[model samples]
Structures are given as structure tokens and as C-alpha cells.
Target: MIETDAAGKIMFARRALFAVLFLVTMVGSLCLAALALSPGGFGIFDVVVLGLFAITLPWMVAGFCNALIGFVIMRFSADPVAAVLPAVELVRDDDPVTASTAILLCVRNELPERTIRNLAPMLEGLCASGYAERFHLYLLSDTGDAELAIGEEAFFSELIATWGDRIAISYRRRTVNSGFKAGNIRDFCERWGNRHEFAITLDADSFMPADAIIRLVQIMQVDPKLGILQGLIVGLPSTSLFARIFQFGMRLGMRSYTIGSAWWQGDCGPYWGHNAILRLKPFTEHCQLPLLARDGEIERHILSHDQIEAALMRAAGYHVRVLPREDLGWEDNPPTLLEFMRRDLRWCQGNMQYWRLVTLPNLTLVSRYQLVLAILMFIGSPAWVGLLGLATAALALCDDPADVMRSDIGSVLLLWILVMWFSPKIAGALDVLLAREERRAFGGAGRFIVNFAIETGYSIILCPILWISHTIFLFGRLFHRDINWMVQIRDDHAVPFELALRDLWPQTLVGCLSLGLVMYSQPWALPYILLLAGGPACAAPFATVTAWALLGGLAARTGIGRLPEETAAPEHLLDLALPAIKSASRPPLTSSV
Candidate 1:
């Protein structure tokens, strides 16, 4: 019997909050040490700090340097060289019409009505696009529930009845949910992929604008060298505080990741599973995923199949690419912080398993290094925080408070924290100001400033929570603990205050101890250290309490900050609808010989 009382809910929230705080403390400590502390201890800190200052100071001082260089180069350089390969226009008078299938992978226990509502646009996309006759849609249900299956069948039937012969839709149920998502797609490919030249994969919550789909097909048809083309995946910020923050930060911080990946990777950019298209033959041929060794920590159905598949493609000498930013698609954000953390934990476990792949034979240096770098970035947060905590304890216990105060290490650490806290936001703010469409979402320059402030403030609060959670997750993985793959809950918005309290109490305890230590010893380094220790210790509750305040403010001010102006469905898409027939073409799909 589950308890319905506030007490139970509060306990859950407190646990969640504490998880985040723990991660932050552990990460902060490690990052400070890694950046400042050298092998010889305090003696090295000065040299390392001065070196970094020299390296970074120039970039800060020479803001106009790159722009001026670019300006001069562009003036003298030949028109940016066009692609040497001529575009293979699929619509050419003599080309064969290529038939492809769309595989929409629906995971465990997904909501029925929402799935249908969200997918309706894609169905319409098939009919409206010129390739209606050449594409078939398959909804692969990994869920075994009898009721949801029945609901999906009915919904699919309704779609057929409305559009008739113009669109074709079908459903498939797997006997086993093995390999998680990777298995789902593999199973479909073995059974249905041979019938199509390409397959567009979609996660349950992923959606692409109609034109984006058309563009995907065009690129695949033009470039036979391309095995996969993945587009930018943006977040849909549902009306929740946590959702808003996630969407805002991702929109800003992820550009560097996206741009850097595409630039450095060229044709080998990693696929993110959804919002992407794949040429069927190459994927089914080269991406025959091998089973992991018995000693491997990752489960058969692990979290990062996408990364693995991309690596396999490169190993097989095929090309994968991140489509330019012009292609637009969106993914729904997990509605609350708890959901986000749960999803991330599953990913951490899987990625930690993949850390071994860095040493796999026959891999390109770039691919190997990228895999290793990802592992470091993911695990480094916790390691950093743990080191910071240990350092604080050492200063308090071993060094005299006066001696620690006189050391320059503490000030360098403080400066590093400040730079990390604000630099990304400043970079993103500049990007937003530069983009016209993003600027409209902020409702002009004044509102953009307000939006940036709210988002940046929330990020500072969330950083410690996520840092703490990651630390706990990394520790658990290192000890070989069992971690479950959980569904990222998308609709729950409000977290009960009692739950928040339960999750936050552990951080509160840590904070109390740190504050007490600083007050009693008055260590010079303690003041700088306590903030990192006390932040998640204090910020979690402050966030949970203040969650409703922003929405309340927005409620009074009519439309101060909102999503971009809704783009109306273009005229051409209106007439197209799902087919009006209850029949599956049941095409014979066999594996490539």
C-alpha cells in the first residue's frame, strides 16, 4: 500500500535533492584540484595557475583578433569551395523512385493519447510530401501491455481511415524487449529494412518539422557516401520551472558541442538515435552489434546504443554526419528535476561501461579520443567534488588556518569557479542576441536580459544538485552496484515540498558541519571552501521553495517571455491527411544478401 500523505512525498523529494547536492560537492573539489594542484602540491599551483592565466588571458584580450583575421581571409580567399560532387537529384527524370520506411520506436509504458497526438503531424508529413507513395510508417511497440497495444491499433486504424491510399501505416510487436532500443531497431531491420532504401528513426517524443523530413530524404538520395545524417535536437520546454531551465541551458550550452562535433568530426559525427535518418543497407550490414564480454558492466540493453552504433559505422568505413543547424527537430524535456536525474543516472552507467571502447582496435584516433573525453567530462564532475571535499578537510585538519589563508591556492580556486559559473551564459547571451528568431522568444532586448538572469540563476542552483547526483552515480558504478534503466517521466510538473525536504536534509547536515568547522577554526581557506560545500546544502530548498515564483511573475505580466511565435502550418500541408483504409501492405522485407 503506497502512502498518499504529504510525509511520504516529502521524503522522496528530500532524497532527490540530496542526490544533486552530493554530486556538486564531489565535482567542485576535483575540478579545483585538477586545474590548480600539481604533482608537487602547493609549489606547482602557482606555476599551473600562471600558465593557464597566460594561455587564457590572450583569448579574453583578443576578442577582435579572430574576427579581423577571418575578415581578411574571407576578402582574399576564393569563394568558399563548393562541393565537388554534383547533387544527385532524386527527382531527376530518369532516377528510380526510392521506397523507404519510417520506424517510430515506442518504448515501455508510453502514454497512448499523447503519443498519437504528437505523432499525428509526422503522419501528415508523409501525405503532404511528394514521396507519399514511397514511404511506409511502422510503429514498433516494445511495450507488452495488452491495453496500450489495443489503443495503438485503434489509433493507427483511425489514421488510415482518414487518409485512405495516400499514406500507409502499420504496427509491430516484439516478443522480447532485448537490446533495449538497439535491439528494437535491429529486429525491425532484419524483418523490414530490406524493403526500403532508407529508414528514418524516431524516439517516442521526438518530432521533426515536415520540411525537415523532406530535406533528410533529399540529402540521403544525393550522397550515397552518407550512412547517417543526424540533426540538431532542441528541447520543448513544457510549462514547468525545471523544464524551462533545462531547455534554456541546453539551447545555449549545446551549440558549442554541436558545432565542435560537426566541425571536427566532418562525416563521422555521432548519431543521437532519433531525429535522424539512416541508409538501410549500410547500417544493417556494418552495425551488426556484437555481444559484450561476460565481464562487461553494461547490460545487453544498455543506455548508449547510439554512440556504439556510430563508432561501428566508422569502424566499417562508413560516414555519419551532424546535419547543419538549419534542420529543426525537438525533443520533449523531462518535466522535473527528479526525472532528469533518473534519466542521467541510467546514461552514466552505460557510458561508464563504454569507457573501455576507447582502447578498441581499428578505431580512428579522433573517435578514440572523443570517447575518452566524453567519459572524463561525465565522471570528472564527481571526482572533482570529492577532491574538493578532501582538500577542505586537509586544510582544516593539517595546516594552520593562518598558513592556509596566506596561500594563493584558495584565491585561484575562487577565480576558476567564477569563470565557469558565468562564461557559458555570457557566450550564450551573445548567441541569442545575434539570432533574430531566438531574440523574438525573449520579447526584445529588455526581456532577453530578464530571461537570461532567471535562467542563469537557476543554472547555478541546479549545477550543485546535478554535480552531487553524478558523484553518487559514479561511486555506485565504480563499486559495481546494480542500476536500473528508468523511463524519463515527461508530464509530472509539481514536486511536493515534503519530498523536497526529505531529499535535502543530507545536504543540510553537510552544510551544518562545514559551517561549524569554519566558525570554530576560522581557517582562511575555509571561507572559499564552505561556499561549494554549503551551496547545494542550501540551494536545493531555496530552489524548490522558489519554483512557483517565476511562473507567478509571468502570470501577472502578459506574455513577457514566451516560446517563439508559432509558425503556422504551411498551406501545402493542410490538404494532406492519413490514409482512409484498414490494411497493411505487408511488404516482404528480407536482409541484404
Candidate 2:
């Protein structure tokens, strides 16, 4: 076991290594950009391009650094999970569960039946663990719809009658969801937080098996210093083509990205607001967010509350860690492009609000950095769009080939940026490929490789479109547009061409104009411009087609973006009858289940 001093030394070394990798990439890339632009004698257009290029580097660099480290760990480590999360070794599976944990199921205007379906497995698992008494389940509702509230009440009453005796279970609903989810949780902490030693926060869409929940509780019980132990949450297998493809990439990207991050991030890791356990006492006392608005106002409240809470928790001297283990925690992602955009925009607004909270006192340097990184995560989108726009305009004005850049250096720089931009997924692919058993679990190396390529192209088409959405959103904030938290629509359905066109015209317009400028001024740059601007150009069609029911079913039939859960589900997940599991002809991946 690593001593406290030894752990601190290892943490320092890893962070320093990350810093070196990030700085090297930034410095080297800027120099390449300067060299490429220097050929024509750096002008205003060249200078602004370089500035935007620099602004875009951190996000990409962070991903590359994390992925590189993560890939190395996955490729080399005998036990990758332990390599990243050494604290896991402190607790034993058979460790006596002593602390009482509050299972916080935070929901707002959600379908109660669906929410209940996701909760039952965990309750049953807890009962089987013979530690059901140690866990209290709270169905905390923030439903605004009158009809939905009725359903929620009925569901809770039924759930309470059934499981109240088996496990300590209760339900509460706020008439007004004041601070949204943050408020919902704050209400819980104030009411029942002191009663329990820990709280496991779960969203309406989140699920954790019984053993996973028990393991987290045990880990926390063993380590009193751990304020937040965030489990890695993968997307649940889905029938929606958009969701499956989106999550397949997520499943691949988040693993290595998380492992790499946890290695250096140590105690200042992420809290994704769901599928994680938190110590309730310090959390209730110290993580209180400054309410943005008054008594009943909802619009002016905090939207992105998880990261700030994590920072505040760290500020209070408690460790916050993300466990980089897969198939333990799962969630249902946005089922279509439109829902995805709405969710992204909400977060963009929320992160922008952190400009005020980032100033909160007592935050550790790393905690402050995490807050800033959250802001940059959204800010980088506009930088990307701006860079692409300026380059397009630069091409439009250039008559001669030597007018803007030296082609060789420009090509190298573009390739470098593209490679780094896709580095997380690239590293994720390598992590799986390097492990023979991992490849088999992903339905063999060949299928996994093919899916990787398809998901990459899907991302290429989707990212820029979302970038435009994010760019527009940031601009709207300047004009005081009200972007508040809205209940997520989490069901499978086909997107109409009209709805896609209405929401995605900006992307299409940008794409069309970019192509026209390239063809008119410098015809040769069209191919290069297509790689950058083409996604938005094809946005409407991309959304409509991917959300088409027939296409989705066909994709599912062929297992185009088949996740491990779909290829062979856990026995526990089998009862959930996930789309893939329902369709599977094979056995589960886990022998014990």
C-alpha cells in the first residue's frame, strides 16, 4: 500500500507529466502554425487565426494528454483499474457494511414507471447483499407537470408499500424545483442527510447493480477522507441508432480518458452528479451553492451544479475521485440529435455561469482549474468555429496558392490538430485493440474496428454541427437569452425532417457558404474545407436519417454500433431486456451472473 507521502509524490509526478505533455503540444503546434503562416508574411487574418488556434489547443491537448496516459495504462498495466484508482485496494468486498447510505433518486417531470423500472434491480441487489438495512432509498421528485406529479405520487406510494419494510424507503416532492436538481439534492441534505453517513446520487436514467452499489459503500466506509467516489457511468444499450452510435463512441472514449485523468487528477476528480456516492455531512455543510435567484425563481438558478459541488467538496479537504471501471454504472443518453443539442446547450449555459462561482474562496488550485476547464470545455467550441470561419474567409480572399500559407506546413499542422482532436477515441480504440479479451468482448476485433471507424465518421459529422449549436448558444447569452434547465425527453422516436431542418439550418447554411467560398476563390481548398465545414452542411439530413426508425432498426439488426452490453449483456441487465440483450442469441459476458 502506498503511504500518504508516497501517494502525494505519485500524484505530483503524474500532474507534472500531464502539464509537460500539454505544454509541449501547445508550444510545438503554435510554432508550426506560425511557420505555416509566416510564408506569406503574417497579416491580420494570420494573427487572428493563430490566436483562435491557441484558444482551441487546451481542450484538445487535455484530451490527448489524458488519452495518451490512459492508453499506456491500459496497454501496460496488469490491472488498469488499480493503477488509476489505488484507493480501491483499501477496501475488501466482504468488508462489513456499517455506514447508512441515502440513495438519492433525483427526478423532475419524469415518467414514474420508467424510473421505478431502473430502481428495482438495485433494491433487490441490496436485499441480497444482506445490507438492505444500511441503505435508505429516497424518491425525490421535482415534477412540475400536474399530470406527471400524479403519476409520480402513485408510483412512489406503490414503491413505498412494497419496499418500505424490506429497505428504509421514502419519497418527497418539491412543489417548485427551485434550483433544479441542485435544489432537489439540497432539500434532501437538509432533511435527511444527517441521518445517513453517505448518499448515492442517481438521475432518473441512472442504474447501478446491487454489488456495484455495495462496493462503493464499502469503499467509502473504509476511507472517511473520500468525499466523493464517482463510478464511471457508461451508456445503457439502446435501440435508437443515434443513441447507440453516440454511446459506443462514449464507451470507447470515456474509459481511457477517465483512466488517464484519474491517474493525475487524484483527489480532485469529477463528480458527474449521478451513479456516484458522496459523504453527506461535509457535503451538506460545505457544498452549499450560492443561490442565483430568490425564493421561487427557477430560471436564474444554477444549472451545472455537479462540478462546482465537487470543487467545494474538495475545498473542504475531502478527496473527490472517479473510479475508472466500466459496466458498473450506466445511463441512457439523449436518443436523438435534437435532444442532444438541447442538453448540450443547457450545460453550455450552466458552465458559463461558473464565471461567478469560479471566484468562490477556499478552492484548491486543482479545483479552480477544474472549474476553469469546465468553462473552457464550452468556450473551445466557439474558438473551433471561429478558426474554421476565418480559414474559410481567408481562402475566399486568396487568389494565389502562396497568399495565406505554405501548403506543406499547413498540411502537417492540420493533420496534427485533427489527430489530437480525435485522440480520445483513437486512444480508446488502441486500448481495446491491445487487449485480446477486450476485443472479443466488443464482438471481435474486426467488428469493433469497423464500428470505431463508423463512430469516428459519425462524430466528424456530428461535432461541427453541435459546435455551431454551441456557438449560437454562447452568442445568445450575450443578448440575455434565457436558457434554463428543462426536463429531458428520454424516449426513442424518429426525428422528422422538418424538425431537423428547423434546428439545424445554421449548420447547413454555414456549410453551404463555406463550400461556395472555397470553390469560388481557391477551388483546390474545397476538399480541405469539406472536412471542417461539411458536417454542418449535411446536418439536417444527418439528424433525420440517423433518427429514422427503419434505419435504426436496420443498424440494430446488423449490430452496427454494438456495445459490450448489447453483444453479451450481464445477467442482471438481461432482466432489463435492453434492446441488444432482448435481441441477443448468446449468453451473458459475466459468468457469475
Number of the top lDDT candidate: 2
User: What is the lDDT for 459 in model 2?
Assistant: 90
- Per-model TM-score, in order, reads 0.76, 0.96
Worst 10 residues of 1 by lDDT: 578-587
After TM-score superposition, what is the CA distance of residue 138 in candidate 1 from its true location, in Å? 1.2
Candidate 2 residue pairs that clash:
none
Error of 2 at 198 (Å): 0.5
The per-residue C-alpha lDDT of model 2 at residue 153 equals 97
Q: Write the per-residue lDDT of candidate 2 for residues 1-593, one digit (tens) a residue.
A: 56888888988998898889989988999999999998758788888989988888888888999999988988888988888777788878789889898999999888888888888888888898899988999989888889989988998999999888899998888998877899899999888888999999999999899888888888888788999999999988877889989989998889888998988898999998999999999999999888775646334778899999999999999999988888678899898999999998988998888989888889988888788888898888898899888888878876776778898988999899888988888998887787777777777777787789899889988988988898998899899786756778888888889989998998999989988888888888888988879899999998988887877776676667778777667877876766655654454323211
Residue-wise C-alpha lDDT for candidate 1, range 1-593, written one tens digit per residue: 35436633653454344334434543554455444454344554344444443333322222222222222222343421111112323334434346575645555657756666556676677666666777777778777667766776776677667765777677777756778778888988898888888888888787666667666777677777778878778765344556655666666555443543343345557788888888888899988666665456544545578877787777777778776452367777776666776787777777776766777767765567457655654665554465445555655575454333334665676665455545444555676676666565445555566667777667655665666777776777667775665545666356666776676665556656665676566556456655556556664565464455456233223322233321122232222221100011122122111
lDDT for predicted candidate 1 compared with the true structure: 0.58
